[model samples]
Structure formats: structure tokens, C-alpha cells
Target: MAAEAQGRAPDRGEGRPLRWRRRRSLGLTLLALGLMLLAGWGAFTVSVQRRTEQLRAESNHQLDLFAAAVQGMVRRLEPMPATVQLSTEVQALLRQPGDAARVQAASSYLRRLNAHLGGMQLFVQDQRGIVLAASDPALVGDDLSFRPYFLEALSGRVGRHFAIGVRDGVPGYYVSHPIHDGAKVVGVAVLKIGLEPVDEAWGMLGAPALLADSNQVVILSSRPEWTYTALAELPLERKVDLQVTRLYGDHRITRFPLQVDLRVDEDSQIVEGVLPAGLGASGAQGRSAASRGMLVLGRTLDGTDWRLLMFADLRPVRQQAAQDSLLAGVSAGFVLLLMLLVNQRRRIVQQKLQLNAELEEKVTARTQALSETNARLRKEVREREQAEHTLREAQDELVHAGKMAALGQLATGITHELTQPLGAIRTLSGNAVAFMQRGQLDAVSGNLAIMARLAEQMGAIIEPLKGFARKSKAQPQAARLATAVHNALFLYHQRIRNEQVTVHDATADSPLAAWCDPNRLEQVLINLIGNALDAMREQPQRALWIDAAAQDGRVALRVRDQGPGLDPALRDRVFEPFFSTKSAGGGLGLGLAISRDIAREAGGELEADNHPDGGACFTLWLPPVPHDAVP
Candidate 1:
């Protein structure tokens, strides 16, 4: 009986050990599964992030290309309006809107020009915005005064706007330039380019494209249905404006149904929502097609107040991440199974070595792939940066070209100045020779002195140019304001006489001095005087007034011209680089801009305003030199 009880007790003890081993094995298996799931989740997250980043980079590149193409297309016709404004027939038409001969000639000229330009519409508008002549004669006498482009052009600026044609209903971009009869904006020359070419350009894009204006109104889009839609809600005032302008030709503006699901970056976003139907989709299919994850990217078009938007499918990125996660899970589960299958110490070590080898090979392959991708991305970035550097260099070269043109104009003035002196010197020498032959010693001597003085005057004129050409000193020196004004007037004495302009130099004897580079101060004075001369060229009463005063350690020199005072609207922009109110070839508009910069460099300022009596007045303020520092 004792032996039988002992055997049963041993069996029970063995059963307890067996049950504990089974429970321990189950816990280990469960832990392995959990570890596999964690690895898969981590892989999925990493893959999603990596792919999203790649998509963002790719979308941005695409957007850049798209914006550049659109800009190139738009700029192709920008010069046409300005060129047409210079046409004699067009100007004549503006001058005589009621003259049939003038209107017919202008229309014929525009017709030929429009045909030459290929698909661009040309028209002329009077200051009242009445179309006096057009390539399409039917458009003649059309009242387009309500158009935004017309209003902008009437204000003496190069105007740009996009809208549908009121008559033809065709979408087009309008570029308008003011036709100046002297200082007055007599009329406008308008060039309207049809969007058919731009629309045809969409064939190159694989995704949807949208171009929105400053008001967030989508003016151009790949999908026809999306056209004329607002990217956001329109303000009541804006709506009223669009209504009055008839910008879209009676097209009702509505908000596009697009919702941003996430912001990936400043210029990238994730969009998810059911937008309006695409090309041909309808009903349930249309909704399904529109309802999808999309990567939206945007960029501003250079040189215009327009934004471009593009979309890419996010399904591919999500799908790739899912596949990667599944692969990671399979790999981890296979490794766990191998570990469980091998129990012997030697076999366990061998299995671990094999698993590690597989993992290392996979990790090495992934790392190589990522490195290759990074290398490609870096190469692209470097290439883009290099391209940008080249563009900047080109811009600098253009600026230098403009400066050279300005120099040529100055040289022309210099030639005129020298011609007069040369002629006088030749006449004086001939007279001197006659006097010497006649035994008139005093007359000959007097002629010689006069000749010498003329030569010296010529030298004085040439000397300013030489100094202006030479590099300036590092620091400003004391300069006599009166002397600078005198030299500037001496350079333009011929023009002043030719134009019969009366000059009033209140500063000719002033004792004011300024702390500034002498050559630069002279240059500023020359520019101010030249501008004053130009302003009074067509005035009935041609007069210039120059004055100087000292106050609070500063000297203010003012140049006032009798011509139509600086257009009240253009007063603030007179000093902007390349913003010229002059006709083509008059100048690049850099004179005032350069003068302003020179003044600021010398610790001073330049400003423009209308004088109380009525004329354009430019004031140059410079740091005053102490009486003791005067040289």
C-alpha cells in the first residue's frame, strides 16, 4: 500500500512540471508575436514618413516647372503692349478719336501687328476707356471703361489682368500700357492673349493644375468645371467688384470643395475630401473618384500676384507602406519560428547566426537603397542651387547692361557739349590768324586769351566725366554745395540754352557745404538738373528753380521744374529702380534710383513732392559740414 501511494505521488509531481513547461512555452510564443507586430508597426510608420517626404520633394519640383512654364508664356507677350504704345497711328487715333482716317489707320496697323504676333488681340483705348480702334473692327467703339486693366493703364502703369472676353467669352490675359502724350496718359494700348495655348500645355502635366489670383479666384485650371471657382469664400466687397468689372463675363463664382486634411509643410499639404466632379465622372462614381487621399502642393508664380496649385495621389505612398509593414511582419515571424524550432545549444547558436545574417543583409540592402536615394536628392538640390546662382548672375548682367545704356545717353550729351566748344575754338583760331596777319597785336592777344578760356571750359566739362568714371573714395569729404550745383548747370548749359529754359539758381552763392563724396554729389546734382530739364521740355513756361538751405546739421537742396508736376500717383515710385515714366530709350529710370542710393550712402535722403506753386520738386538732404570743416 505504501509503495502504491508513493508511485501516484511521483506521477502527480511529474504532471505539475509538465503543465508549468507548457504554460511557459505559450507565454514565449505570445511575446514573440507581440514583438513581430511592434516591428511591423515601426516599419510602417518609417516607410510612410519616408515616402511622404519624397512625394513632397517631387511635388515641389513639379510645381516649379509648371509655374515657370506659365510665366514664360505670359512674358512672351508682355513687351507687345509697350511696343504698340509707341505706334504713330495709335497715338494719332488717341489724339483724334472722332477722326475716321486716324481710326482706320490705327486699326489697320493693329490688325497687321496682331496677325504678326499670332493669336493676340490688339486694341487702343482712350483715357475714357472707349475703344477707338481694334484689330477686330467690331470691337471698335466698345466701352471697356469698367475693365480693371483699363483703369490700371489709365493710371499710367503697365496693367496686367486675366479674365474672359466680354464679347467672345474666350478666356485671355490682358496686358495694357499707358500711351503718354508728353506727361499725360492720353490712352492705353492693350494686348489680349488667348489661353488656348496655355490650356494645350496641360497635356504635359500628369496631375491637376490650378492658377489662382490675389483674390484666391481660380482663373485657370486643367478641369474646365473648376474654372472661375474661388479657392475660398469671397468677401462681399470683392464680389461687388467682380460684378461691376464683369471680369469673368457673367460666370457665377463659387467656392471649390477642397478640405486640407493635414499640413505637411509650408507649401505642401495633405487633402482629403470629395471635390467637384472631374472631367467626366458623375453620380456615385464621381463622388468615389473625388473622395481620395491627395498630396496638394502650391507655389507663387514669379513676377505676378498668382499662386499655382498641383495635386498628387497619396494612395501609392500608403500602399507602399502597407506592403513594407507586411514584409517586416513576415520576416520577424520567420525569425521567431526558427528560434523556437532549434533547442540544442549548438543548433540554437547556428540558427541565431543565420537569422542575424538575414537581418543584416536586409538592413544593408535597405541602407544602400536609402543612401542611393539621398545621393540623388542631394544631386538635384545642388543642381537647383547652381541654376539659381546662374539666374542671379544673369540678372546682374542685365542691370549692368542698363547702366551701360545710361552711360551711352550721358556720352551723347557730352558729345553735344564738346561740339559747340570745338566749333567756337575753330572760329577763334581763324579769327586770331586774321588779326595776326593784319598787324592787330591786341586783337590777336585777346583772341588767344578767349581761345584758352574756351579750352579750359572744355577741360572742365571733360573733367567731371573722368571723375564720375573713376572709383570713389572710401569716405565722404566736405563738398561745396554751390560748386556742385554750378558744375551740374555748366554741363547742361547747351541744353538749357537750346530749350530757352529760364534758370533761377538761388543756391549759386550759398555758403552751405555737405559731407559727401564730391563726385557723387556732382552726379546727384547732374541727375536732378537733367530731370528738371526733361520735365520742362514741353511746358509752355519752361523754368527751373534751384534753392539750398541749412537746418539742424543738414543741408537741403531742392530742384523744382515747371513741367507737369510729378504725377501725384507716381511721386512715391519715382525713385524705384527700372520704374521709368519716360518713353522707351529716354532712360532706364535708374538715375533717380542711383541718386537716392548715393544720398543714403552719404548719410542723407532724397525725396520728391509737388511744390506749393505747382511743379515737381526733388529735395536732396545731406549731412551738413561744420563751418570749420569747409574746404
Candidate 2:
């Protein structure tokens, strides 16, 4: 009995060992599966992170190239206009007492000047502010007293750049030279350079570039649509936030947000935010996560109301993290399959002892197939992530290209606008100098007063230019639509008279007002009026009718012109930048585009349609102003 009991104990003890072995094997399989998953997840996470960094680096590099190209183009074109003005001034001064013979001789000289200068327009004005001769004969005998350049030159300030304007019904610059006769003021020689040359010049400057006022208002851009926007309008802050949040601070990436202090350095440029540790992850949650990082590139232009900024976005690095997560899932599945195979082999081998070898072989084969499937999935995820990254880069490039093209058109428009006033000022100053030298103190003082008035006008014109060129700040205020329209009309009063375009203003007696920038509203009016004038340029009975009324708790201002009706096809795209029916060299195509944007930003709407009486009509709708507000 003792021997039998001992034998059973041995068998039981052996069974206990087998059970312990089976449990140990299961634990080992699970551990191996967990380790495999952990390793695979780790690798995927690392790979995704690395790829994200690479994509960000590539995006930044592309932005850098764009910035560099824009900088080069701006620098090159910066000095050309000033140089042309200086040369024209010198030549015009050489011809004095610009009488018929002298005027004829000046005309020949201007012709020669135009011939050599290539794309530059030249004209000569006498002391009486009459166009004695012009590179384009069509402008001869035209009175330029109402022009800003005429006023500026008559004031005696030299080498001052004027805001943009229209001359002889065309967009051009008017640079002047004082004709002096033995220290006596006699006449003014003027140059009217068409803006097409400037456009052509900007075209040569690769990449998109914008010449903006100190406030970051786009004065000119390769992209016309951008012209109406100030620096503040751009989602630069948002872009900075995105960059900091996604990229953190990867030195490999460029084009970060920056605060540029123009007063300190003309060539000042900086990248905003320091790179955070752990791929830009800040220790703090929301505070650091805001991602307020940016790259600011800037350059001052001839110490004027102009500055250039180049910026790019960096927010494509988050995709890498998704790839890593996917890889982790793949690795886990693979490990799970391996564990399942081991479990199946053990269960089958124990349950059916005869099939143990065959089942083991089958399990091994299934495990191999699972491994191959995992490998393929991992490859596909990597490939998909890469493709998405590439597509994003391509989209960014395309957007930037579109912006550049628009900026070029804007630059041309600005050049044309500024040239007219500058030319008038130059001629006026030259004549003023000649008069003072001739001992005509009375005339000099008179000219000075004219100059003062012109300066004031220039100041007024610059208000909008500054507003447009400077960064946008929310400066909403109660503005009277009637008063604003009157102010705008005052600026173009002389032009209206000159063009024989009658203006009929019938503003409602009730005070119509809205919260807006007065200067910006005035600009919208100017643009509308300017367009009206252009539309009536060929019309026999030219007229502009302005009617302001209060309706539906809104102030509506309508500007109707007697001219050729607008086409239905053009109406939809009339407000689109660079969409113009005028000749290529005729318009910058931004006036209406910017006007609409301004109107919308001010909670208003600008609409255009053919009037029932045969012409185009532009209506500006604004929210009603309060009854007790000051004008």
C-alpha cells in the first residue's frame, strides 16, 4: 500500500510539473507579444516624428526661397523710379522760358527722352500750369493746376514721391524738372511715365513681392488681391500659433512668426518664439500650446511710408503623429496574431495528441502569413503619410504663386496712381523755383500757397494710402455717409470739372451713418468715382449722379454714371482682383476689388449693375448711423 501511494504521488508531482510548464509557456508567449508590440509602436512613433520634421523642414525651405526671391525683386525696382525722376528733373531744368520755339525744342527733347528711356512718358508745363508739350501729343494744352505734382513743384520741395493718381485719362507718373533762366523761374519740364514699364520691371523679379506702407498696407504686390489687405488682415498671428503648436521649435524649419520693429533697423527681420523642448512641446498646457511662433522678414524702402514683409506657414508636422499611431496598431495586431497562433498550437496539440505535429506546422505557417500582412500594412501607412505630406507642400506652393501674381498687378496700379501726383508736384516746384529766382516774390508766394494746398491734398490722398499701406487695426467709429461722400467728392471735384463730368449729389436730409473708418470709406468713394470717370471717358454727355438714401435701416449710396453699360458676364467678376475689361495698361483692376473688400469688412456691401437709363451703377450699403452723432 505504501509503494502504490508513493507511485501515485510521483505521477501527481509529474502532472504538476507539466501544468507549470504550460502556464510558463503561455506567459512567455504573451510577454514576447507585448514586447514586439512595444518595439513596433516605438519604431513607428519615431519614424512618424522624423518624417513630420522632414516635411516641416521642406515647407520652411520653400518659404525661404520665396522670401529671398521677393526681397531681391523689391530691392532692384526700389531705386528705378527715383532715378528716373531725378534724370527727368535735370533735363527739364536745362530748358527755360518754354515758349513756342522753346516748347517745340522741348518736345523734340522729350521725344528723344522717351525714345531712350523706353516706356517713360515725358511732358512740359509752363509757369501758367498749362501743358505746353507732352511725350504724348494728346495732352498738349491741358491745364494741370489741379494736379498734385503741379502744386508740389510750385511749393519748392524737391525729390518728394507723391501718391498715385490719373492724368490725361490714363494711369501714369508725372515727374517734373524746373526750367530756370539765370535764376529766374520760367517753366516746368515734366515726365509722365506709364506704369506698364514698372509692371514689366516687377515681372522680372522672380517670386511674389509686395511694396507696402509702414503699416503693412499693401501698396503694391505681384498679387493684386493682396493689395487691399493690410498686414493686420493677414492671419499672421494664427499662422504663428499653428507653427508653435505643431512644429514646436525645430531648427530645421524656417518661416516662423516674428515681431518686426521697423524703427530699429531698416533691414530688420526676426523669427518669433524660441523652439520648445520635446519637439516644441511646452511644459505648460494651454499657455505653451498656443504656438505663437513666426518668421518676419522685412526691408525699409527709401525711408518712406513703405515696408516689405515676407512670411510663410509651418503647420504640417502633426500628420507624423497619426502615422506613428497607425504603426503602433499594426505592431499590436501582429503580436496578437502570434500569441493566438501559439495558443491554438498548444490547445490542438493537447486535445488531439495525434495531430500535434501537423497543428504546430500550420500555426507556424499562419504566423508567417500574419507577419507578411503586418509588413505590407506598415509600408502602406508610411507611403500614405508621405503622399499626404507631398500634396500639402504642393498646395502651399500653388497658393503662394497665386499671391505673387496678384501682387505684381497691384504694384503696377500703385505706380500709376503715384506717378500723376508726383509729376504735377515736380512741375509746380520747378516753376516755383524759377519764379523765386526771377524775383517774382508775389508769384512765388502764390505758388507756395498753391503748394500748401497741394500738400494738404497730398496729405488727404495719403490718408487712404497710409490706411491701405499700414497694418489693419480695428478702428471702428460712427461715420456719416453723407459727410464721407462729400469729402470724397471734394478730392475729385477738379477732376470731375476737368472731364466735363457733371456730378449730382442728393444725400438724404436724415443723418445716415455707420461704424467705419472714415478714410477707408472715402477711398471707396474715390474708387467708385474714378471708375465712373473712366466709364464716361468716351461718352459724349458724361455725367455722374450720386444719390444717398436711408432704407431698411441702412444707408445706401449710389454712384451712377452715363457711359457704356457693363456686360452681364463681367458683373460677377467685376470685384475680383485683376478682372478688368479696360485695356491691359489702363487699370490695375484692384479699385473695385479692394472697394468690395472694404465694404464687406465695414459690414457693408458694394454692388454693380447697369442702370435702367443706360450706364453702370455702384451702390454702397452701410448700416444706419445714430441720430445724435457728430459728422
Candidate 3:
């Protein structure tokens, strides 16, 4: 019958609280999930863009180096053909092409030079383009009349051409200079140098690098398969010329397959890599490795028709960028989530305040109704009286709870404080007992007196707690602030000793005079010191320093602790009542708020901030009294 009378839904008092809790939980969960998704999405896009830019810059730098290498190689090898024509060995061989001894000696000398220098097959050819004494003895009788370099040299000018060797179908650069026999051009001296050495040098760089001719043919390539390939389709005229000269031998002018991913600049670009047709068709998975992304940069060599190119794998850079951006975004999102939590907590507190106000209004109305019904019904008056008693008891419980919080901190220190004096009394009493047994009357009396003093010291320690518990609304007086500091240290002496905490009195030289109740001030200091001890529980070294200084015509009493400083984000809320960083049952966070109120009543202020060196500094600024009014 009672459940039916109450209706289908639970009471407002019971179900409302549960409903609010559920709402809060749902909101927080949704917010956290949203943060993660937003962070991931934002991270991925931003990371890709930044990674691309960085790789582009790196590719450009590599391109500069590549171009410089080709230009430097050209400068080094360009003069060799003309310079070798003037070589004494070459001149002797050219002066007497029919001399067998001179021919052998010249070919041997050319072979040694070609081996030491970074070039392939340094040789000599006659005016008719016939292979004369050569670096390779097998090429001595090879025909070269079909080549353009020899024809150009016979016209009394230095000539250069890239063509296949007339002796073998192997491609090489042909450079020729006409030999002068006393001011008349008699024959042409030619140098045939292969590009294999340049290709080998490019391979050692650990990147895909290549050199291409004016016709866009990949003449020298670090990757063997890429050689003889063209970057783009060749025109008919160039193709026909290459075919006639047989520059690339029997190899087809195939195009290197690449898919452009992005263009970094005119000289540098990015591409996606995959196995080429032949490699893929042959099922050579390991042989032809796939690249995620490759950066390629190209530049033309100065004074030459060749272009230098560099390619690098950019997969690692992109991956790192992704990781870095995700970490940054997640960190930012976490900070934002914390801010949301704090804002929600603020709203919850405001809601609690509103509920309290509404409850108070309802109670007032209920009291008025009970008062009016008392005359009509005496039975209800007793019930109303019981309700008042219950309300008073609830108020008392709240006060008791506040006192318990302070007492919990004092409890540990009290135990440690009494231990030392109690031990001393025991020792002295034991000595007295021993002396009495030996019939030493004077020594027994002396030990008894010492025990009495120890007992009195223990009483002195217990006396303050009684006064602290019975706090009074006492008015401020002109008292020396240093006295309160000393009392705090004295009360916490046992805790300090037990915890191995070092205490410093920076204001011992100059006493701090302030207008405040000494007992109340001492309680505040004890509270701070106890809190410091708890904070430094995890610290290896514990220390506390009390500093006093004059600031803005007021005496500031600062308590500093060598413990982890107050969190910057939570510093503003530290003085709020019932706000605590400690775990459940540790504290109610009422101490600092109460202390601040007491300071205001005593014409003082309390402020907290992080110290310059480390830890937290709680400064109690009081109205300064003259030295004459120190008491």
C-alpha cells in the first residue's frame, strides 16, 4: 500500500540525485570520446602537410648536392681529352702511328692513367677515325669513321659527342682534339670514356641518383634497370639519331614508370613507387622493393647538356611526423578535457548551492505551517519539536566532522610528541627504582625530581590541544608574530624529529610584530606545518623554512616547504572550503579557508604561491606593530 501511495517514480529526493549523477557521467564520457576523435583527425591532416614540406626541403638540399657532383665531374673530365692530346706519349704515338714499340708504350701509359683517374677506357684514334694505339689492346684496329667526334676533329676543331663505342656496342663519351704537326692538322687524337665510373659513384650515395643526356635518356644510372631508360618519351628526331649512332646499343628507350604524388618545386618532386611491369610479371617481390614515397629532385649541369637527379625514400619522415603530431594533439586535448572537468565541477557546486537554498526555503515554510497547527493540534507539536531536535543534531554532526578533520592531523603528531617525554619519565623512574633498591637516598630523590619535570613537559604538550579544540572568537592584539611561529615549531617538534624534517627560522634576527590572536595564529601555523609533512612524505629530503619580512608596510610571515609545490592549475582553488587534493578521508580542505578568515578578522591576509627555488610558499601578511608595542 505504501509503495502504491508513493507512485510509479521514486521520490524526488532519492531519484533526483541519481538522475543528476547519471547525467554528469554521460556528459564526461561523451566529452572524452569526442576529444580523442577530434585529436586523431586533426593530427593526421596537420602531420601530413608538415611532413611533406620537410621532405621537400630535404629533397631540394639533396638536389643541390647532386647537381654539384655532376658539374664537378664535368669540369674534371672536360679538359682531359684536350690535355691528353698534348701528352708526350700521345704525341709520340701520333707522330709515328706505325711504330710498334711506341704504340705499346703509349697504350700502357694510357691504361695506367685511366686506372688512376676516375674514367673508363682512355684511348687514341687516327685522323681517319681508326682506332690506333688504345688503352685496351683489342680495340687497336676498330673503325671509328662513322662517329661524329672524329669527323669534327679532322676539321681542325675540338669536338665532343656521346656515342656507342665503334669497337664494341658499349656507350661512351667521345672527346677529340686534332693533332698539329708543325702548324698543320695531320690527325685526330680521341679519348673514349665510359660512364660506368660515374654510375658507381652515384650508387655509393645510398640514394637513387642518375645522370641523363640532353635527349632525356638515362645514360648513367645507379640502378641498372633504369639505365638506357628515358624520363619522358623521346622525339622522333632524337630517337632516329640515337638509333643511327647506336648510342644505347640494342636496349630499347623505355620510359621509367613513376606516379607523381606531389610537386615540391620545379626542381624537386615526390612520387609513389611500385614494382615495374617486368619485375612484377616475373614475381620478383624481394628483388624489386616497393617504396611508400620517394622524393626526386633534378637540376641541369652548367655548360653541359646533362642533368643530375637524386631520389630518396621519404616514408620514415612521414611516419615520424604522424607520430609527433598525434602526441602533440593528444596532449593538447587532454589539457582541454581537464579544463572541461573543472568547469563541470564548478557547475556541480553551483547546483548544490541552489539546492541548499531551495531546501532552506522549504524548511522555513514547513516551520510556519507547524507553528500555526500547534494551537489546533497538540499532538503535532511534539512531532515538530522532535524534528527541531533532529535538525540541531545534524548541525552538531557537521561541526564535529570539521573538528575531526583537524584532529586527525593533530592525532599523529600528538602520539609522536608525547612519546619522548613519556620515555624520559620511564627512564628516570626506573633509575629512581634502582637507586632505592641500592639504598642511595639522595640519588633516588634527584631521579624522582627529573621524572616530575618530564611529566610536566608532557602536560605542556597536551595543554595546547585543549585550547585549540575550544576555539574562541577572540579579538586581535599587538603581539610579536615570532612567538606564534615558535609555538608552532614547539608543538610540531616531535613530528619534525620523527620525520627528520629540518626547520629554519629566517626571522630570528628581526622579530615580526603583528596584530593577531596568538593562539589562533599558532593553530594556523601548526596546520600548515602538518600539511607540509604530509606533502613531503614521498620526498627524500624534508625541510621547512619560516621567513618574515616587511612588505607594503606590513609584516609577512611566510611558511615554505621543500615538497612538491602547489599545482599551478589548482592554486586558485586551494583556499576553497571542502576542496582537497588528498585522497578520501585524508582531509576536508577547511583548514586554509578557516585560516584565511581568521587572518581577515585579525587585520591580516594569507596568500599562497610557488617559491622561486621550489615548493609552496604560504605567506601570512599582518598589520605591523611598532617595536614599542611588540607585546
Candidate 4:
């Protein structure tokens, strides 16, 4: 019995070593599997982060396009409201709202203008906010005194607002401009543009977007149900204000079911939401990807207290990340199993040696490649510098040549101007001498006076030529833009008169100033005006319009000609050096090129485009100088 006990004890001790080894092996396998799981989670997190950023960038780009379209529409309509100031009927109606004849005339005029403007409703309201006349007969006599836009215009300002129409139960964007009787505001002219077109356009873009006002109420949306819904919770005060203003009319404003599950950043978020019935897609079956979840991005509209929000579907991004995570986990498991089955220690050592050797070889090869690339880059940089220097020298020569060409072109007109004055002076002097000989004192004095006036006239014609021919140092400072426009016109007076062109000068109506060299500004204006005149040379009813206005910290002067508009394909190439549409020997085509350079030197830009009405328009934009700074 004692011997059997001793044999069992030795056997048990032997089995202890096997058990210990088994347990150790099991622990290592578990650790590897755990690490693999962690790696999978890490991959998933990283992928989600990357994909979210990509989605954000894409949404931002789309937002920019949408914002641009919105702003363009508003800008197109904004000018329409101000055009009412030019209507005599509108002016007459405002002066005497009680006059039935004037009211009918204004209404008829507005109706015609509205038809021409694609059905935008136009109305004129008196100082008392009583609608005297409107393109839509039903809108007349409507009391709009309580409206914010009316109050804004009455305070002598341009008013812009978006609201639901009280009469028609439709949404519209209103633009109002004051009718000024000298310095006093007499009445308001308003244009109401339907938002359905904008909404429809947005819907066609596929991506979901909404436009929210300052109170966080959606005014315009690609989704109809989203309109009038609050993007966030509206405070009591805001709700009261909306009710009082009746901005959204009788529409019940409620909080949208948007829950922010994650805040990506200040301008981005992951939200779960569904739009209202009117804004949501009708007859939709189950929960769509947008309804399930979406990424939201927001941007403030330019020049307005409104925000544009875009929604991007997030399902694809999440699905892709999940698939990548699963693949990573499976790959890790497969690699782990192979390593365990092979003599893990030996295989790991071999892989480490091989990896280190390959790394060293790759490092050496990359160093050589980078060194060669660096040398090539340095050579290319030198070549580029030389090329730029040569181009600059050539540009300078071209500028000089352009100035000479302009002088040559003006020579004909200058000669005609000078000859007339010279001939008159000669005749007057001869007559003065004849009168002196006859001893008619009073007649001789009159002849001498006339001769002196003729001599001064000749000097006036010669002075501009001398000033224009002589190059002046570039010194950008405060200068009157209106003055530059007038000076350019003075240079083209002879050509303008010869062609019988009707000139409309709006710049003379206001004091506009810009930061630019007076000589360079005049030169640019002269080039623009010359181009306009050339464009109108063959046109029967020639006319030119020059307008200047200060906007967004810049002064813009536009020269428009009544001629065949520029060809679309040629518009972009118009400023290219040596590019021209002129007849042979008519111009060197360096005028616009040199003018553009001068504009840039003075921190401005020159733009060319075909006006919407009819003609080529050249606009020069310069940094504005404050009214007080104008010397």
C-alpha cells in the first residue's frame, strides 16, 4: 500500500507541470484576442472621425454653392425695388395717394413692370403705410404700418424681410426702398418676390437645406414641412414677437424634432430629426436615412441675419466604418492564429530582422531620391524666378506701348479739337486787328475779348492731353471717383458728340471716393469709356451709362454701353494681353491689360461682363475712402 501511494504521488507531481503549461498558454491566447478586439474598436473610432471630417468638408462646399445662389437671387430683386424711384407714376402716386388718376396710373405702370420682371408684385405705400397702388389690385388699401419692412423704409433705409403673406397665405421675400423727397422720406416702394421658386430650386439640388431667420424660425427650406418650424426651441419673447409681427402668419410655429446626439464642433453636429408634414416628403414609407440620422452643418448668409443649414446623410459613413472594423478584427485573428501555429518566437525574430533590413534599405533609397528631387526643385525655382523677371520686364514695355497707342488713338480727336479752337482764335485775332484799324473802340474790345476766350479754349484742350501723355508716379490716396468719371468723359467728349451718344451720368448724384492714384484711376476710366465708345460706334441709337456706388467697403464704378454684348467665349479673354475684338489697326489690345495692372497696384480689380439688360459692362472696384477722408 505504501509503495502504491508513493507511485501515485510522483504521477500527480508530473501532471502538475502539464497543467501549469496549459494554463499559461490559455492566458496568452486570451490576451491576444483581447488586444485584437481593442484594435478593431480603435479602427472603427478612427474611421468614423475621418469620414465625418470628409462629410463636413463636402457639406461646407455644398453650403457655399447654395448660399451663393440665394444671395444672387436677392441681389437681382434688390435693384428692382429701387427702380421704382425712377417711375414718374410711382412718384406721382406717392405725392398724392388720394388722387384716383395717379393711383390708377401707378397701378397700371406697376402691373406692366411686374410682367416684365417675371411676375414680382410691386407696391407703393404712403408715409402713413397705406398701400396706394400695387401691381396686384387686391393689395391696394391694405394697411401695412405695423410691418417691420414698412417702418424700416419710413426711417429712410432699404428694408429686407421674409414673411408669409397675410392675404394669399404664401411665403414671400420683400425688398423695400424709400422714396426720398430731397433729404426727407416721402413713401416706400416695395417688391414682393415669391419664395416658391427658390424653394423648388433648392429641392432639385437633392441635398436637404433650410434657411432660418434670426429667431431660429425656418423661412425658406428645401423641405416644405421644415418651413415655419423652429430649428431650436423658441423663447417666449421670440414667439410673442413673431406673433405680433405676424412674420409667419397663422402658421403654428413648433419645435422641430431635431435631437443633437453629438456636437462635432461649433458649426457641425450629428442630429436625429424628422421634418413636419408640409416640409417632409409625402407618401414616404418607413424611416428614411435622413429621418434616422444626419449630419448638420450651418453657415450665416452673407449680408443678412439669416443662417443656412445643410443636412448630410450619415448612414453610408457609419456603414463603411463598421465594415472596416469587422475586416480589421478578422484579419487580426487570422494573423494571430498563424503566428501561434508557426513557432511564434522564431517567426517573430525572423520578421523583426527582415523588417529592420527592409526599413534600412528603404531609408537609404528614399534619402537619395529626396536629394535628387531637392536639386531639381531648386533648379526649377531658379528658372521660375528668371521667367517671372522677364515677364515683368515685358509687361513694363507693354504698358509703355499701350500708353503710346492710346495717345495715338486720341490724336485724331485731339487734332479735331485743337484745330477748331486754333481756327477760331486766328479768325478772332484777325477781326480784332481789323477793328483796331477802323478805330471802332467798342467793337475792337469785343473782338479782343473773343480772341482771349478762344485762346483759353485751346489751352483747355491741350492741358488734358499733356496730363494724360505724361506718366505720373503711382501714389494711391483718397480721390473722388465721380471726378475720375467726369475727367474720362471730358477726354471722350469729342468722340461722344461725333457719335451722338446719349450719356447718363449717375455718379454725379453722389459723393463717392476711393483709395487709388488719381492718374491711374483716370486712366482706367478712360480705357473703359473708350472701349464702350468703340462698342457703340456702329450702333444706330448709341448710349452710355456710367454709375458709381459705395458698397461693402469698396467703391464700384460701372461703364455700360448700348451695343451688341460681348461673346460669352470672349468674355474671360478680354483682359488678356494682346487680346482684342477690334478691327485691324484699331487698337493694340494692351489697354485693358495695362489698366488691370494699374488697378491691382492700387489694391483694386477690374471686371468685365455683359449686363443683364443689354450691353458689355466694365466695373472697376477700389477700396473705399471714407467721406471725411476725401480731400
Candidate 4 lDDT by residue in tens digits, 349-434: 78878799887888899999999999999999999999999999999999999988877856743563365456556666776789
Residue by residue across 1-631, what tens digits does model 3's lDDT show?
8788677445666888999999988997787768776787688777766876777677766667656765565556756666666678778888888888988988888787777766767777777777777778988877766666777788887777677665577877777778777787766766666655566577445677777776778788777777777777788898887777666677888876542222324343223222222232212322333445555556666666676666666666668767876787688678877888899899977887879988788879999998878766887777889999999999999999998987775665456446545665666677788999999999999878767755665665554444434543455677676777775676566568888999898866666667776656766786687778788888999999988888899888899999999999999999886688888877767667667766776778889999999998899888877566664
Tell me the lDDT of candidate 3: 0.71
Where does model 2 exceed 4 Å of error?
1-353, 365-498, 505-515, 549-553
Per-residue CA lDDT of model 1 for 468-530, tens digit only, reads 344233367888888889867865776798899999999888888889877678777878888
TM-score of each: 0.50, 0.37, 0.44, 0.50
| 1-631 per-residue lDDT for model 2 (tens digits) | 9999987998998899899999998997788667666766686667755864564455445545544554443333333323332444334533543446655665666676677765356666667778776667667777766554565565543322322333333434345556555566455655554545334544443434455543344545565544534444336674453344321122122221222333334244422222232233323431232353323344554434445543322233334555565667677777677777998889866776777778789889999999999999999999999999999999999999988876665566566455544555666678789998899989888767766765665555554443444434436688777787776676566567788887777763536677777767877887888788888998899988888887788878899999997999778989887688888778877788777777777778999999999999999988665556555
lDDT of each: 0.80, 0.61, 0.71, 0.77
RMSD of each: 29.2, 37.5, 21.8, 25.2
lDDT of 3 at 235: 89
Model 4 scores worst on lDDT over the 10 consecutive residues at 269-278
Q: How many backbone clashes does candidate 4 have?
A: 5
- Choose 3 or 4, whichever is better by lDDT: 4
**Highest TM-score against the true fold, candidate:** 4
lDDT of 4: 0.77
Best by lDDT: 1
What's the distance in Å from true for residue 473, model 3?
76
